[model samples]
Target chain A: GIQVEQSPPDLILQEGANSTLRCNFSDSVNNLQWFHQNPWGQLINLFYIPSGTKQNGRLSATTVATERYSLLYISSSQTTDSGVYFCAGTLQGAQKLVFGQGTRLTINP
Target chain B: EAGVVQSPRYKIIEKKQPVAFWCNPISGHNTLYWYLQNLGQGPELLIRYENEEAVDDSQLPKDRFSAERLKGVDSTLKIQPAELGDSAVYLCASSPGGGADTQYFGPGTRLTVL
Candidate 1:
């Protein structure tokens, strides 16, 4: 089983600030995903970046597969972004995913 | 189109009681998954179904947990005589078959085993 570690166990910021969350895995992975668990307990898919970079709205993510690390960027954060962010991944053909502890974010107005 | 649908937003029961949760995946989706998330933790895969067949369930605790996806559209998870440690949020997600596509998740069912 692979290991995933997320940095900045908790973060608090103003509504308009920006922040970056990181995830590091112990091995090469064929699938990597970032998810946001909202206050209502819905696990929303944020990104499925096994490698390279992707952007959606004010959020973006980059995965350096060779380095076994990934980064999620939240620009101009909003109140709705307050939640626990998790990163999960799996090796090729491995059906089970290894997840990081998660980073809890709180955005205040 | 509707996303994944799960029933019983919250449930509280005794440690030895039996509990079940239901999930309906998105229309036309062929892959279904069940995950467990403890408080302040990430979701961990418990089972994965491709159509009517369970392709992966290595992480599922077979002693008291069982799941079924009949007819490939809807699924159910059952935990009999659950333990206090079984308290967690159960999440259901669905995705199109094959490829590295995104998965859609439903609002999880929170269970509290006393």
Candidate 2:
């Protein structure tokens, strides 16, 4: 079983500020994903980055599989981005995906 | 295409009562999963189904929690005589295939046992 830990469990920033969240896994993983859980509790898929880096608008994620870590970046954050961001990964040769506790972001307008 | 669908977005019941939650995975998805999330924690896998067969359920409390996916497309999770400790959010997810495929989740069913 792979354990996932997230850094900066809580973050508060003014709207338009930027932030970075990190996730570290205990072991090698075959796949990784980022999700944003909105205030309504809907887990919206952000990215499926098993490795390398990807960007979508103001959000981007980079995964260093060799280092067993991932980073998510948010630029020009908006008040709507106030929620929990989670990173989950599937351990090597395992189908189960383990998730980090989450990074709670609060963007004040 | 619609994402995972779950019914009864919220449920509130007295302790020792029975409750059930339903889930309909995305069409053509072969892997369906049920996860439980306690407040301020990550979602934990309760059961994993490869179609109609439950390949992984070691984490499920078989004594009181039971789940079924009759046609391999829709699933139902039931808690018989539920306890206060069972109060949490139950999420349903699905992937195109098993093993490392990206999983999509539903809004989840929030249950509160009084």
Candidate 3:
């Protein structure tokens, strides 16, 4: 099993600020995704970047597969961004995803 | 179109009791998954279904946990004689069968066993 580690296990920011979170995996991955778990426990898919970069609204993510690391950026963060961010990955042809410990984010208004 | 749907958003029961949760995957999605998330932790895969067949269930606790996806559209997860440690949020997700499709998740059912 591959291990995934997320940096800054906890983070707090004032609304409208910006922040970046990083995830490092122990091995190469064929699938990588970033997810936001809201207070109500809904897991929202934020990005499906196994490699390269992608942006959606105020959130963006970049994955360097060769380096086995990924970074998620939140710009002009809102209070709604307060939750746990998780990075999950799977080896090539693996059907199950192994998850990181998660980064707890708190956005204050 | 409706996203993945899960029933019984919350449940509470005494230890040793039986509990079940239901899920309806997104239309036309051929891959369905069940995951359990402990407090402050990320979701862990319990089982994965490709249509009516379960392709991966290596992490599922065979002794007390069982799941079925009849017809491949809707699924159910059951826990008999549940223990307090079984308390967690159960999430269901669906995706089009492929290597690059993003998974759509349901709101999840929170179960509390006392």
Per-residue error for B38 in candidate 3, Å, reads 0.6
DockQ of each: 0.68, 0.80, 0.71
User: TM-score for every candidate vs. truth?
Assistant: 0.96, 0.98, 0.97
Write out the backbone clash pairs for model 2. Answer: none
Q: Residues A15-83, candidate 3, lDDT per residue (tens digit)?
A: 999999999999898789999988877889999999999999999999999999999999999999999
Q: How do the residues A31-51 of candidate 1 rate in per-residue lDDT, one tens digit apiece?
A: 799999888888888999999
- Ten-residue stretch with the least lDDT total in model 1 chain B: B95-104
- Best candidate, DockQ: 2
Model 2, runs deviating above 4 Å: none
Q: What is residue A88's positional error in candidate 3, in angstroms?
A: 0.7
- Give the least accurate 10-residue stretch of model 3 chain A, judged by summed lDDT: A90-99
lDDT tens string, model 2, B19-110? 99999999999999999999998899999999999999999999999999998999999999899999999999998997757788999999
- What are the per-residue Cα lDDT tens digits for candidate 3 across B40-105? 788899999999998899999999999999998999999998999999999999999944368889
Instruction: For model 1, state the Cα shift of residue B7 in Å.
Output: 0.5
Candidate 2 vs candidate 3, DockQ winner: 2
Error of 1 at B81 (Å): 1.2
